[model samples]
Target: MRTTFLVIVLLLMRNDAWSFVVYDDSKIWNQDSITFYFLDGTSQQKNEVKRFSQLWQRYTGIKFNFTNKKPSFFNFKKFYKISFKGKNNESTNGAINGLIQFGNLSDNIIFRKTTILHEFGHMLGLAHEHQRQDRPNYLDNKQLVTACMKNQQQSRAWCNENLFKKFYKKVFIQSEYDPNSIMHYDISNITSKDSETNSNIPESLNNSLSFTDKFYIAMLYNPKLDKKTLKKMHKQDIREQQQFEAKANAE
Candidate 1:
């Protein structure tokens, strides 16, 4: 019952000439490195997050650090580091503070690893792969909503907000659908869309990041990805997130 949505923000930079450099990618972080802290949590829970968080840093070179000291409120912060709190298994995107919530981590080792990977994926600016518009039509949306409501003990409204909503741009499309992706769910029930059926069932959850996950995350946050390639991907995601807002206004 995990869900994620993008938050739009501008990351303006400048060169020696003092001109603005636009890095307005809503689906990715404004910078490569970010800091986060736990407002309160058990040592075990904090250890779990610290353990699985390394995967992203290893692959994407995005740094995550937490601190124990508090900063003065008078500093007037522009960009904010996330502060993880709450006991729910939810994560939010962007440079805003108070993003991730590590719900009571279950004893299942694999499940614990997967939860951290999944939530950190959102923390690192990834949306639900299953929510992509170009995704195959094998998902049972109604069943998904119902299952989330029951198994996750979530409300219908909460389920829709987190799980069922589509995040896409009608005019632009790009995807790297990996069922084994940490950003995806493993639904064993019947497929309710195209006759594709079981052929498209996402494989059971695993404790590791899919190959595509590492590849793309590196591209998005690392130096290997060129400007042309980065802009192409960023613009499509922008159309998917930011421009969607603009489009919705005219409708």
Candidate 2:
């Protein structure tokens, strides 16, 4: 049964159309405090996730409460349910649904931290950075397809079509292509283009949130910032990200 659910998740992760359905803003948790319940994972893993949640809370306005036993029926809707089953880690795009499925975490502390941070970004409604509409300017589709094929051990045809649709489809958002963002995947060997050159694309799987990441998250959660100001800041962030990517490629 667990294997079947994992397979379903894998399929869902590959279907970009399904992602659109999951990425609903109405699902975002509007409350200041949220609860989380662990259906699986070691105590250490749970602690790690809790720690990471706190790390994000420090930067944003939200708060987290971890519970060992499931909350009562009255509070069940108020808690996020987390499970460790799938081979690939995935989380519901926002808090309204309260479901997160994670894969194995490395014993290495740093690796585990980075993985959790990325997953939490998804929980906060952030999509993959590479899926940003502007990404094609910095990434080559063919090269990305090749990389996807190799990474997933799928056929070239499958990668070129279905996998590409699943992972690389353009997402419309108010943010830029922040390669340094924890939400960005490590595509160093896969990327075929960047501002400086096409070869030797710099790898970026951040262990922590980048400057733009912090700024964007703050903008997302802060009620003080108006829509116009947020748009302006997003543009500024794009400029900075472009400069950073260029410098990284030149190095």
Q: lDDT tens string, model 2, 140-171? A: 44666766665556578755543244353432
Could you tell me which residue pairs clash in candidate 1? none
* Residues 130-240 of candidate 1: C-alpha lDDT, one tens digit per residue: 666556676644666766666667688977876677664321113345676778765542123332334555555445676567656654556465557655654554354
Q: List candidate 1 stretches off by more than 4 Å.
A: 1-24, 72-87, 170-173, 189-202, 225-251
Alpha carbon lDDT of residue 184, candidate 1? Answer: 73
lDDT of 1 at 7: 20
After superposing candidate 2, which stretches have Cα over 4 Å from the reference? 1-24, 136-138, 152-163, 166-173, 189-200, 223-251
Model 2 residue 49 CA deviation (Å) reads 0.8
What lDDT would candidate 2 get against the real structure? 0.61
Per-residue lDDT of 69 in model 1: 46
RMSD of each: 13.3, 10.5
